[model samples]
Target: MSNTGAVMQKTLLGWIISGAIADKVVSTSCNLSIDQGLDLKLSKFWDIEEVTSSQNNYTAEEKACEKHFIENYRRNEDGRFIVKLPLKENRQLSLGNSRDLAVKRFYALERKLCQQPTLKTQYTEFINEYVELGHMQRIHETKLHNADTNKSFYFPHHAVIKERGNCANSPP
Candidate 1:
């Protein structure tokens, strides 16, 4: 398995254990506060110090980047950076913008998860497991599809690429 898969598995296991402990603690300690219960449960199975240190390192790196960008980048009257580029560069810029939007959405979701630390364990477990399962399902489907000779998949868009006699690189 890749490093990401291993990390997800470990995180899922941790959350499962933590959830079980939390359930037991809540059942037995009727008067205990949610925070106290969570603390007790996490202390038993989770390495709080390690997680905190990792989070601190991430935060520090982010702050450093923000500081650097603020000091180095200049904005125009529209409160944005102005750059001059040739018409040929527009396509590349559009593609880059799409990638940036995806990254922004991912970070926004992470920020939401951080804001809800109490539910972080369960949420992380669910999201990671769900995503991994989906990936596995897609791989399985692709393998099955590849085994079938009746269907075909195309690349470079259907309108752009065409099968012309013995030549495979011809445009439609």
Candidate 2:
């Protein structure tokens, strides 16, 4: 296979291992299959250090997802964070994959991460960074009304806005 082909194969393996394996974790029906393929698949999915420490803890779905993402996604070598952004110029770093797919994968990871309260912190932190970058802002105000039964609700639901930078002027 060509280099791109090899990378693509790795990427597909990573997604299958990480996403699907995570889905089936802790089920008894597949224990034997896991026993037969888990170790080898783990080797394919993680680096040596990660494999050493994490081998015993991962569910098959988690393993599959890990392998999938690692192969397709550009991650820090020390494994601190997965680069969630789409392919960028001047970075010389990419998963050698498509942007739309990365966004889809990110949505998946976001859903999974949000399930853990601690992981939600990462989102908040990223938002803060985005705010600093001026890429994110508060832009609107909602008018609240108490309808017939006397329940109050904001009109237009939750909306985005540009931050006014005035503490008193900020939305409640």
Best by lDDT: 2
Per-model TM-score versus the true fold:
0.21, 0.21
Q: Over all chains combined, what TM-score does candidate 1 have?
A: 0.21
Off by over 4 Å in 2: 1-97, 135-172
Please give, for residues 1-172, the per-residue lDDT of candidate 1 as tens digits. Answer: 1222211123422322222232223453223324566667777766645555444556755776655666667779889874442223234322222333544665776776688775566666665786888842333655744543333222111111223665566554
Candidate 1 C-alpha error for residue 171, in Å: 57
